[model samples]
Target: MQRPQTVVFTDLDGTFLDHETYQPGPALEALEELLAVGVAVYFCSAKTRVEQQAIANEFRVDVGFVVENGAAIYATAGAATVFGMPYAQVREALHNAAAACGAAVRGYGDMDVAEVMEHTGLDERRAQYARQREFTESFVIESGEPYELSQAMGELGLRLQRGSRFWTAQGEHDKGMAVRHVTTQLGPNAESFGLGDFDNDLEMLTAVDTPMLVQQHDGTWRDLHVEDMVRLSGIGPVGWCSGAELVLRRHNAR
Candidate 1:
């Protein structure tokens, strides 16, 4: 197989999609340009595999995806490189860890489909997709401090990561580990780029040669510090566009 010279990994929520609207309208042009030049685009995010595949289907461009906060990587061929514990295992461990830490948490497993729709602002169909978790669990911390819960989780070799809206429990993993896995497949010379807008994205950003942070909906950048990281001023898709433009220039595709 011929080697890819450039690869892009972007977070979905609050990075490539609007935090509230979940639209990628502004970034479409740049995204198309990247695709036109055969630049690989992968959505690396906390979204479920179904949600990620839906986005890829909508845009019709997905070399692969890192889903559930790096719980797994799904190639376009449908093969998955898994890094997370099974969903059932993670869910059970989470409750046990939370109980030990005296944390009151409400996970998706505890919610009905309707309640998941309400909390996530997803329609019934999308809500079902969200609940179709294969690995890890997303939950709201109802009454416990995250620090204590995190420590308790560590004892079981699990971890808790905070996304834009909820906390996730899974095997110790992060987007960076998945990013590295994809780039390695692309070969050592492939220049990887990543974009994100939250602390949850720090690991992913650090894993790329060109890391960029999009401004949040509140017009602020994440306090994510990484060497040679670029800060884009626009929120969500706008910032994604700017970053994509830079990638195009770097790849000499524009």
Candidate 2:
């Protein structure tokens, strides 16, 4: 039988990047190896296209990426095909939800660069890139229970994704949808591996042939069950490398 094509999907913030430094760290070498072997590595993250674009340039990679928690997918050098509600409509809905629920919600669209930097610890320039959102709005609820906020979002035909620090309001599309879409496009015989380290990655981590949960900076793992999924030891890029090497080895052996 022919060996299946190998494809890797990785989360950015706390999977491919160091949770604290935001550097690729050990995953850098692994990424180079993957690219050297012509294996496709696609970044899957809640980050904006601007942010992922810069990362793609830095890595010298052109493989398509899923951005904003799969709100959209941008093929290499192609126009973005969005699967979720547009940012303008989501923002408007959020405002209405906040007003109706009397919740003190602060979304990325509502904050200035300074505020974003303060809240996210990203430098001013990176914060500016993050603010270039197109399909999803990440916000924090300061005065309302998370359940209440989720209920409000549900009533508006939206959903809330609970991240480690914030909640994202978006349409029904998620990383799983994007992953499946891309992999199916590659071929029915392609093999997929997904790596992630947070709640936001739940759907993605479960939607792959090889799901990998990386250790967190705090030495914990996201509580999710995926049959036959691999749990890597190292955190962030360290775990990313370990998992990549393992999967690639298996692929090569086949």
Candidate 3:
């Protein structure tokens, strides 16, 4: 029997891409090697479809992606498999949740490109891409703990997820669900690897066969306690380099 095809599901902003420069840096070589071997590198990220698709196109990769914190998955065939509410519904739900909890919140739908750039420091092009969201509403709470907000959203059957920069409100579907869906389509010939650097990455990390934590920008790990997890001892894309090489090592051995 043929060996299972390797697949990597990764977070983007502070994992595969450098937080400051937003480039792959040292992970480029390993990414190339993986692609050379036909490994699918699905970018499971908080980014929107436009942003993720731009990256895939820029890198010349044909691998599908999970976008908007698993609100949708793009299969290798270029068909989108959406798993949750539409943008208008999600935005309305967030507003209702915030009002119900009396919490002050500002989501991307409430912000223009200038405001988004101000909050995120993304360039004009990236800011435009961010605004093209379809499923999740990324926001910030100007108030205190999100406990009340979480409860409020939960009442409406939505989940509040925290990313490295923002909190996103979407349906109950998560990265793990999206990854599982993709792998299921790949049948039994799938060996999955996951890499992340923040608390929001917990679901995706736990769903994969090999879960690796990339070092955070502050030189610390994400503090997740996944079983048999590997902590790559480098920061941002530097740690991503370690993870990519490790995946290559395993792939070559197989």
Candidate 4:
């Protein structure tokens, strides 16, 4: 039997983190363990690069990361490379898109980093902690159809990614593309696993050999690809962590 070396990529919110509080549970420990055993851990998130970096720092692991829904890729310890649209173009297109749709646009760089906590109703302590670090530019808009947003972003030479919560301007990037990019950098033979729990995660989940879904309390799992899926009996981060352990155990046995 061939033992496949695995790399794990996870989405942040509504998957690993509690959707309401943004807290990590037992699944976080499983992630650390995976890292200890040399399975690469990467974060593929709708978060801005700044937000992702703060979380990565908390993990104390130099994992590769894909941010802005695949608009940018950052080396664990080096420069961040843009894979989608340039920042300026994304800004302009987002402004126009917001105007057309009567929506508001918020950029990580435009407001004080503290504003995220206020806007999203995140904890103030978390916001303060985040403010202490350098942040990457991220933008959010509330309007436009998914395809329309995608096309306009494309015209600006950037990628628009739609996630569970919001639409963001990163560049022309998606979680699927980010997964492929990281895999390519790690070499072709590395086995990969993807974990997520929402519509935006579909592409990444489909791209990996072992895809896990973090079950939610509202029976959202029923609407996803449940066939052959390894369901976590728990909810939030605990369920995600449970699912990861199961996947790791199964992988090791093979």
Candidate 5:
């Protein structure tokens, strides 16, 4: 019997990378193992291409990546391409919606490097990279009801995603749409495995043949109702490694 070609779509911050130190840690082993067996692991993240590029270089893994919450995709062999609304349009709509809703919204583009560093705990270089938004932008509501902001955004044909630390606004497409796009390019026979740890990851998690949810940094798991979703035992990358290994073992055994 021929094994199905494996492809993994994973969240970065709190899934493949440690939520605190932002390193792959134990997940590096499973990543290498997957690569050795010709599996492609695409990072689906809210980070900009610049930030994702830096992380990819740090890990020394060459793979396709979906950035800006599925706003764009950068294949390992081709240029980056947009899959969502233009960043300029999204920015204008966001501001207009926030104003109409009477919410004080502050996004990454509205902040300097110092302010970004203060808010995200990222160093200056990373903060600079994070601010280079090409598709999606993250903001916070400083002085208004979140529901009002959400209602306003929806009225303007935009959507808001609640991430671990900030609220992101972008086009209709999310990580699941990006994953589906990548899967088609991988050929009809390729099977997908997705791993994530937050509500924002729900789309990607539910789009895969095997969906895995790992424990968060604080030891709580994101509650999601997906068919056959696997909940791993460890937190962050530890659970990622375990879940990946388990999936691979079961997949190969069949």
Candidate 6:
């Protein structure tokens, strides 16, 4: 077996960030080592561009980021390349759907970050943290069937990515597509690894050569399509960091 130049792409929440402190642990060190050896690290996440950019800066390295659940891609220098439906088109469709379902449609584009925070009742600090970086954009419909919203977005040339607590019109774009794009850019001989821990990460996990899911607070592993999905023993970023290191060690041995 050949050991090709590797690139690791990881989802943020519940994967790279400690669920409590929102900080990276040994995973960051592992990534640094990979970079020391000429490997690349990227963050593919549902987080907005703003959020992902901040993380990239914190790590002090350039990152290829897929924001808005793959609706947009951004390079480390802050140049953005949108891949899917325009936000305007998605907004119109979501508005129509909200009216039909008698729900209120709220999003980040139409309002400032503060307004979105108020509507969603999210913590102000977290909202500010998300706003400081501009990588993600999302819309939610309050009071309607989530599937109805999904169907509506589908009709409008958008797709709904269902997370633990919200539905958004992100289009058919997903982490899998983002991974393919990055891998293609990196060349055919490049090896890939992925880490994630939620329903939204399914496509991403399937696209990688190695997929690992960090354990949740409940001590259960999220179901994944990969045949060799490894369940980490700890919760949040610690588990993710440990799992990523293990995967790399195993792959390097092979």
Clashing pairs in 1: none
lDDT score, candidate 2, position 239: 90
The models' CA-based lDDT, in order, is 0.88, 0.86, 0.88, 0.68, 0.87, 0.71
Models 1 onward score TM values of 0.92, 0.92, 0.92, 0.77, 0.92, 0.83
The lDDT, on a scale of 0 to 1, for candidate 4 is 0.68
Clashing pairs in 4: 27-241, 84-172, 85-158, 85-171, 158-171, 158-172, 159-171, 159-172
- Residue 224 lDDT in candidate 3: 95
Count clashes in each candidate, considering only residues at least 3 apart in sequence or on different chains.
0, 0, 0, 8, 0, 9
Clashes counted in candidate 3 amount to 0
lDDT of 1 by residue, 54-147 (tens): 8878877655889988989988778889998999999888899999989999999999999998887889989998999989898999998999
- Over 110-213, each residue of candidate 6 has an lDDT whose tens digit, in order, gives 66767868865657765776544233346556577777766665666666666565556655677788887877876778878888888888888888877778
Q: State the lDDT of candidate 5 residue by residue for 129-166, as single tens digits.
A: 99988888888779898888989999988998887679
Q: Candidate 5: give the clashing pairs.
A: none
Write down the worst ten-residue block by lDDT for model 2. 56-65
Q: Between prediction 2 and prediction 4, which has the larger lDDT?
A: 2
Off by over 4 Å in 4: 1-4, 77-81, 96-115, 124-154, 158-165, 217-222, 225-228
Model 2 residue 133 lDDT score: 91
- Pull out the clashing pairs in model 2: none
What value does the lDDT take at residue 213 in candidate 6? 85
lDDT of 3 by residue, 1-254 (tens): 77778899988888988988888877877787788887888999888889999998887767778998888999778788989799999999888989998999998889999999999888989998999989999999998569999999999988988765788899978889999888888778688999999877898999999999989889988789899899998998889888988888888888
By lDDT rank, best first, the candidates go 1, 3, 5, 2, 6, 4
- At residue 170, what lDDT does model 2 achieve? 94
For candidate 3, report its TM-score.
0.92
